[model samples]
Target: MDDLTCDVAIIGAGTAGLAAERSARSNGATTLLIDETFGGTTCASVGCMPSKLLIAAADAAYGVRHAAVFGIGATATIDGAAVMRRVRNERDKFVAGVEDSIAKIPDAVKICARAKFTGATTLELSDGRTVHAKAVVIATGSAPMIPETFDAVKDRVLTNETIFDLATLPGSVGVIGAGPLGLELAQALVRLGVETMVFDKGNAVAALKDSHVADALHAILEKELPVVLGVETQVVPDGDGVRLSWSGESSGERHFEYLLVATGRPPRLEGLGLETTGLALDDHGTPTYTRETMQCGDAPVFLAGDADHDRPVLHEASSEGTIAGRNAASFPDVTAAERMVPFSIMFTEPNVAVIGVVPEDGAADVVVGTASYTDQGRAKVMACNAGLVRFYADAADGCLTGATMAGPGVEHSAHLIAWAIQSGWTATETLALPFYHPTFEEGLKPALLAICHAVHAKPPPFRDDGFLPGT
Candidate 1:
């Protein structure tokens, strides 16, 4: 077998893997990244980039067909094929760009030829070769989940993997989950005139945010893609179309024509050399990381991306990968034992974004503020009545601790809140900061105001911080 070596080796070339490689290089360290596909998920194929691109196209077509909503009396027809072509072209350009970028990295970052571990410090390539590295980072991104319960016939059923390849919209689609993937695809399909139904076993889609914010999202999405919010769906063979069985409770059980499973992801550690390392993996089959610093304990191995903990998002994975790569370059991360990691979430339509924590989650005190969409300076011009911005403060010092938002233009507000929380600002200071008006950003007002108005009000007694906790 051929033998190889590198200072640091990364198992995936997705966003996280690439980020690690880039970060490692900047730190003047040698690194290597390996994956079956160059761009991994979002940048290349079926992750956020391509999905959002198609959704944007569908939204554009919808706007064209429904111009009356904007007070412009006009009639327009949609050409799905033309819009799809634009989406494909744009997606291709992005994937190509991602590949071209990673290729440009210097020799310090040597990409392996698809290697899996045969030993603790050694790996076997696809072509009967061997390699060794001082350290290894698992950035292997997740694949679209296709549970075995569903019929596996290629044409009749599809996973998130095959959905993007669809030539034309189906008459109806029963998406099998309510999370980001399912809802995103379901919404896009409906916008393109496909009768789409988003089915989920539970309310896991955008479930991490406040229930009030989720209600707002539900209302907006109900206007288009009908959500089977409280259903426990099971897939079976149904001749031309698949059959999905789910308890509708009051509605009993329901079936569907097409099925798209966007349930969750399994780590890509099977063929790779996890057996060679002594890392911790659960029965659910996820690699565990040291909570303090993301290290895999004694071994020179670290886990990032979906393989790290199944929170499958491009941005989070990439951020983790960069950290892993940086730590790998510096031998091992002994310093990060005290550093805290941040969490980020993204969504469609008034995008549900949250950062920091409520008093219930941690610490002794809490502060909150809010700004609503209807009262924004530009709400009149936009004719919008949706969106809320919330901020949390530590009761002891009145310092900003966390923030969350739902509405248009909250993208900028997420950054503002993140900075305020990380910078240790107080409610009074944040309120005094210059905030532009007539935008969804107006939502940030209420949470900060709450911090000031509600002095002794502590957060709930319990802290159920799922994804991120502000300490």
Candidate 2:
């Protein structure tokens, strides 16, 4: 094939790469989208969609099992095969949607082959074609990190990349890592009647930085499955299964049909011949880039999405891609873009979400407001009354800074808090907004009110209709 050239060349066809391609094209730049395979996004293929499908099934089973609390007699026999079949089937639909989007891009703009950097503005294709571009964007998505300790049980190990492909749910699973992925999957599996246990060397759960929220999550998850934290765990292949032995919080050995490793995902940057680009690399081999501009040093080459190792969630990836693409198209005249407030959610029952700034322990400049579902009216009505919600505000100004929460309807409440923080709303301002009565969202009011009082910014007195005056 003849040498290919474009004004902008984007590596990887995942969420970030696709967004970069669109942004570049819309910016009046001719672009080449290169990847080993097209139309396969991590979110659609294995990461978000598939996992959610499995979680949905698990939630159904849990609802059925706990129906008695609602004064309804119900029982469920989970068909593992059927459950997985639906997961795969629905997951394929999501993948197809991504493929359909890729199909809409002009053929001349898409390169169905792997690419490696030959120079700052040049790439060599695996198929023997060379491309020289004015600017480049690296969006190669990440892969699950498998620790070297699990090498002995490699055959029995399953990461997010391979776990969804199981033909049937395993009889038992030992999850290594207490992060969101591990805990979410472990809980789902246990709810589906599989014996599951989670182990982690750290003393936290999910991505929560607040000790209170982390402890609440750990406690809630433990009621469903054994979550052993702060432990030194050893794994080894034992016949057809894997044996996990831990000594720290407790000492015991257990065997499971499979070990799910959800430790973390590092950017997939290996073998990309980055040294030829002459860009400075960090200790972890990632190119040094400014988050605001996504430019590597002063070079035309840019990094986005998981490849940059900054906020690997889908939305952040897309946002980074847009910024990187536009900046790459603009080249040396690149402009920096403002970033959105950080927001993330784990789809556990009574979701876990962390938004914006998380104050350190005993931070004098931060005031915290808290609420517990243990006595929340709506939560008690739904029989899901357990978890904690906390809002952190600037002690000096009472402006909402961030929040870490693990509670019923937190996924929605977190968004509100994140928006309030982004809009520079203070506790008084946020409390002025209406909160419906007897709803899970109303639980957020107590926390906001606490912030108002803590920061010495009391809300206005309620009017005759029992509503605080609008700010």
Best by TM-score: 2
Q: Residues 1-471, candidate 1, lDDT per residue (tens digit)?
A: 546677788788878788877777687766666666465455467776678887787767667766777878765465666766776777778877876887787654555567787765577777676668887777777666676677454356667667666665677788877876677777787878777788776753555555556666777778777676776666666677776666764244445567777877677777786766766777866566764445777678777877765446666776677777777777654437433325465646656676766444434566556566755556545555576666667677667777667777665668777777777777766667765544555456556666765664333234121211111
Candidate 2, 38-107: lDDT as tens digits: 8589999989999999999999999999999999999999999999999999999999999999999999
How many clashing residue pairs are found in candidate 1? Answer: 14
Spell out the clash pairs found in candidate 2: none
Please give the range of 10 consecutive residues that has the lowest summed lDDT in model 2.
462-471
Worst 10 residues of 1 by lDDT: 462-471
TM-score of 2: 0.97
